[model samples]
Target: MTELTIVANIHAKPDQTGLVKTELLKLIPVTRKEPGCLRYDLHLDNDDPAHFMFYETWESRGLWQDHINAPHLADYKAATEGAIAEFTLSEMSLIG
Candidate 1:
């Protein structure tokens, strides 16, 4: 199966950027250890502190789906509910 690449953009409310960033940071350690996770990286926009992005690669879509439903992910959602102003995710293929 082809690997899955995920690009997730998260925009936090102006007043909630700190909260969102902290919660996002908490996911890194655990997610990196999950099965099938090839790479999981987080980036912050230089011009916009409230804009964050995650670039992830998994062995397969099935494994990525499993990661999506993880308990920690749920916790993140719960914690950042009203703090997020916008969220966008894209699934892509890596074609050399």
Candidate 2:
């Protein structure tokens, strides 16, 4: 099966950038240890502090689905309930 690539863009509320960033950082350590996680990297926009992105590669779509339902992920959602302004995720295939 082909590897799964996930690109997630998160926009934090203007006043909650710090909190959202902190929370996003918290996911890295744990997520990297999960099964099927190949690469999980986070980036902050140079000119837009409130914008964050996650570039992830997973072994398979099913494993990635498991990751999304993890307890830590649920906690993250609850913790950042109103702090995020917008969130977008894209699943893709790497042709190169």
Best by lDDT: 1
Tell me the spans in candidate 2 whose CA falls farther than 4 Å from its real position: none
lDDT of 1: 0.99
Clashes of each: 0, 0
Per-residue lDDT tens digits for candidate 1, residues 1-96, read: 899999999999999999999999999999999999999999999999999999999999999999999999999999999999999999999999
C-alpha lDDT values of all predictions:
0.99, 0.97
Error of 2 at 84 (Å): 0.7
The C-alpha stretches of model 1 lying farther than 4 A from their native spots are none
Which clashing pairs does model 2 show? Answer: none
**Residue 3 deviation, candidate 1, in Å?**
0.3
lDDT of 2 by residue, 1-96 (tens): 779999999999999999999999999999999999999999999999999999999999999999999999999999999999999999999998
